[model samples]
Target: MTTYRFSTGETIKHVVLILGALVVLLPFYLMVSTSLKAPQEIETNRGGFLGQQEMMVDGDCVRQGNAEEDCRQRPVVYNYTQAFEKAPLLRYLLNGVIVTVSIFIIQVVVALPCAYALAKLRFRGRSLVFGAVIVCLLIPVHAIALPLYIGLAKAGLTNSYAALIIPWTISAFGIFLMRQFFMTVPDDLIDAARMDGMSEFAIVWRVMLPAAVPALLAFAIFSVVAHWNDYFWPRIVITSSQELFTPPLGLREFKGEMADHAYGPMMATATIIVTPLIVAFLLAQRRFIEGITLSGMK
Candidate 1:
């Protein structure tokens, strides 16, 4: 005995949101579709969604004098196999884990205390220091890239893990986000901690940190995604080190290395690279939404 309906504006908003989602997801669909398709299907753009998935012969296997029977495999299998076999995909994945984890850990260590101080402490020039952090948020990474690269080069730190990790140790946005979240926390909690003989450091770690878990999860996603997908800075600093190449840099293997570009395997590699982030976001989706909603409540 109940009827539900949307108003005209609400219906229009829903339609627009659905269209925007399709636009965002279309590239991912094509990447996954192409990864499953044969080269002929890809070139012709004939595959529907999952592709024909017909058996295809790998040219490299045949060129290496393998039997035709042995060389024939399904397009999906060929593409994924070539993705891992064509480069040190596992090594690149490990490097991504290392760099992203390192940067996140360092950023949390630095940002949490800075956020705590900015939010809780009343000291001289506190507003000025906080103003500086806000200013830093406005400065784009590209604006400071040359100076950071040159400083690293001068210090003989280029091509090392330090080069990757050091530049991102202090994240201004992380500090800002955590500070805003901390402002929403009750001042009584800090006073209680101080009554318990807890120093400022202890207050930050014990009092502020536990309450900031949602915000930290939100920051972690941002830090990990940015560093994991970063190719430009890594390309500049790790020019000579293949061992140090992140997942994004590893895609270069399929670009111009072979006589013919391996679009299927390249797409497969991209799919592989993006899978973890998607899984992570799904797992943290609730907390991420909660964090964003609660962060600006002050």
Candidate 2:
């Protein structure tokens, strides 16, 4: 009886979880579906899914020839061609890659050391500083945008990639994450490395870094995703040159210049913009999950 009850409980839990996952995934499914759909189908079909709710205009569609066109499906490839040829899509992608990689690399250099210091070294105002970082995590980027922009302008960094990349190199959240992961590292390990004639820096590089591989990788993914998907900062800083545009900005330009309200090309541009992030996640899925799951949790 107990075994049957356990099996029943497990089955119920899985069914609930699967439903929840589907619910969460529905929006993404729609985005991809609509992007692949013909422009006419998008206008006519109030809801794309077979059994989804939609507003019915009681024969309005049938009354006009456009009613059929509204339900007409577009060839997905044509939308993509229009999206790409209409804008500097390739330049946008290259610029995005450069800025995103720069942000993550610089973040690692700044974050890792500060994280190590907070984790291992004894110092004055340490707890206070840690508290400040935690507080900073609560603050949104928009709150600081104006001041940051002014400072960058004054420092002559405006209109440069430095404007986008430098200020973000030292992330307070990254420090918190690294510190939490480092705390889990045994103190004895550091001491042994010291006894073996390893300096503090050497110990950090040789001992702790190797030990913190998962956490580092986790942060790298987080850093890449955050910066790569971000469009606002790039929009603000990079204005003069089309060459500096990123994927998101490029897609926006495509929509603005060519579409004027054309949904097919807009959808195609969106699909192109998101493809890299999706591919990255797919390829590094295990590492990304493992890193986040274990880091700072214990």
- Which candidate achieves the best lDDT against the true structure? 1
lDDT of 1 by residue, 1-298 (tens): 8887869998999999999999999999999999999999988889798888889899889999999999999999999999999998989999999999999998999999999999988899999989999999888888888999999999999999899888888888888888888999999989999999999999998889999886787777767778888888998888788888899888875565754548999999999999997887688887655544542443
List ranges where model 2 is wrong by over 4 Å.
1-74, 260-262, 282-298
Over the stretch 1-298, how does candidate 2's per-residue lDDT look in tens digits?
4455457888999999999999998867766666565555667755454313233222333576556545432346545655666677777778888988999888877777778889998999889888888897777787888899889889888788788787687788888888998999989998999999999888777888899887788888777777888888888877776777888878767666764335656776787788887887789889766644543453
lDDT of candidate 1 at residue 133, scale 0 to 100: 93
Any runs in candidate 1 off by more than 4 Å, and if so which? 1-23, 282-298
TM-score of each: 0.86, 0.73
The lowest-lDDT stretch of 10 consecutive residues in candidate 1 is: 289-298
Alpha-carbon error at 252 in model 2, in Å?
Answer: 1.9
For candidate 2, give the lDDT of residue 101.
90
Evaluate model 1: give its TM-score. 0.86
RMSD values, in order shown: 3.1, 7.6
